[model samples]
Target: MTSHNTFHKVVVLGGGYAGTLAANRLRTRDDVAVTLVNPRPEFVERIRLHQFAARTGDATINYRTLLGKGIELVVDSATRIDANTRTVRLASGRALEYDYVIYAVGSTGEPPASVPGAVEHAVSIAEFESARRLRARLDALPLDAPVTVVGGGLTGIETAAELVERGRAVTLVCGRALAPTFSASGRRYIATWLSRHGVSVLRPAAVSEVRQDAVVLADGGVRPSALTVWTAGFGVPDLAAASGLRTDALGRLLTDETLTSVDDDRIVAAGDAAAPSGQPLRMSGYAAGPLGARAADTVVSRIAGTEPAVIDLAFTGACVSLGRRAGIRQLARKDDTAVNLYIGGRMGAAIKEVTCRFVVAKRIRREADKPGSMSWPKGGPRPAGTVSPAETASSAGEVASP
Candidate 1:
């Protein structure tokens, strides 16, 4: 490692999970100067957005309390990146130079633009402002009004469950099967649990159009609702594309195994904005945090004249809340393969709560400790030629049998 005075400057953009962890890790290092740039002064606990929509008031985190001593937190969005000069242009008309940069801008929910009147009428619970808007709408709606939650993904399911617990009439509309990514057993567990909680599930039905008071289905059926929530999909911000970096069709930066931008190594992408080299994982906090931590370690290793290590996908699971006291825990292998392990009821809820608390505590610890000063474990790029299970599976599929 370089001497404290000789270490270079590092700038981390986006103070979400990935950016916050990156800044915290780098601040621990006495040699490197760290700066965190984000549009909001506070960190939004994005995973708890559903709770906020249910009027739980759980989406805010104080950056001042989370940032370490040497790390500078800049409340502004990064608008431009000059890879050639290693400079980042902020939306606030400030330019910062850095030896390394970590991009963790996260993502935004896709507005209900496809369905007419949905964008103007439906509520989204993705961002802090959106959740607040939804909460206000819920408070003003009639007690017996029907609410339709579009999409059956994790976000949609969680939102629907939370609303149901609030004594609201909820209808979950899924175009296909619910929790399609889960194992067969997990899918059954979730469907049964949701059905038992007074949530009506509509499957194999596509929303032809969304009106102010009802949604028209493909089969010429209409579902009445006073409040509609659209959680169908998410769209990453166009910052990378706007800054002239390479991005995939969905606007996610194409990243290699090391989480480095395919177009520019000086700029690394993480969190929801990064697409894995071969096997692209779903955009979730479970994956984003590790990717962010790995990206930070990669930048540090490069500066320390050591080769960057490849990421090891060890912990991959899905924990969904059915309500305040019930949840479903679906386990998965390192290769992103789902297993038939389901945890539900009160015990599952406790597990889910603990998991969320662990994430928060982990961030707190990282911020308190900082980066380079701590002695991190050492391992090679590929773990002595033994590829990760995900990599091995992909390689085997690519080989031609004799």
Candidate 2:
């Protein structure tokens, strides 16, 4: 949109949903040079990580296909960012200067060493490499091997359900109630589905430590587990914080309502790593696409010397796949409160499958074909004094609430 003849260099760190969206959409401008930096050459479908761990499908989309022409894709990691010099230092000993920077690095899983004795016994499918390792482990295990999944969040639920469907003996460990934010009816439905699949749900039970062949519970009870999959919570990379950018408690980059850094207008943020208005957003699908687009639009507006609108996101529903053939879609209020509306059983499964097929590139294609094709939840614009995403847990692996 800018009339300037000079090309603007834009460096996008991380190639997650938000990073991909920003890189692709920014290509709509002929005057901008978009360079996407990611550690892997392939695009990771983080949504299907559980399925990947269950040997359902590979969790990759060729980055070559996802990114359009004119966008440079760098296969490397950003080791540091020097805001004073406006440059990004990569792990490969290379550096790139940029007119604008997009911080879209998403959430990640911790290694076993992160938790007590977990490294020696547990596994996590938080990234493509880790997911591949999990799939390999699943392939090598016996059919009746007992696998315990820690965390009652969406990732834990999906991983537990998927493994159970594959005929593995599965148990879900939760520090609190399963799907605690969901409405009573929604929780009941989840419980019913999990029970029907023969998955053991251990609620009010916390895994104090993960052992090689057993899990030590908070109550001093030990449960035998041939395999342990950790899906508890996700944490963001410390790149922003390490680079001297202001970050929240969870290390998410702090931004203003327009999705730009409160300290530097040259920097913008979106996706899970963005904390706007002193509040952080949920690290789930609920915020990914919407925040990604808003961040891109803000960068574009800035280039064109126009003001970008404050990010206004809404909530509609979430789709969670129980297995290959069963799923649940939970609708919610604009503020993301669970409602009684839901579609369960085979129909919900079909809906979930359709949603999974939605890749980040499709969004770029839409933007190139349609100028204002942003999809908002519940028609967007929250009501006065409504709670924002900071108040709720946005697990990428969950969908239904009502």
Model 1: ten consecutive residues of lowest lDDT: 393-402
Clashing pairs in model 2?
112-119, 318-399, 330-400, 339-402
Q: What is the lDDT of residue 227 in candidate 1?
A: 87
List CA RMSD, all candidates: 5.5, 4.0
Give each model's whole-structure lDDT: 0.77, 0.79
Error of 2 at 396 (Å): 19
Model 2 lDDT per residue over 324-366, tens place: 8888888877777779888888998898777776545346456
Clashes of each: 4, 4
Q: What is the lDDT of residue 25 in candidate 2?
A: 79
The best candidate by lDDT is 2
Candidate 2 regions exceeding 4 Å error are 1-5, 111-114, 359-362, 368-372, 378-402
Give residue 15's error in model 2 in angstroms.
0.9
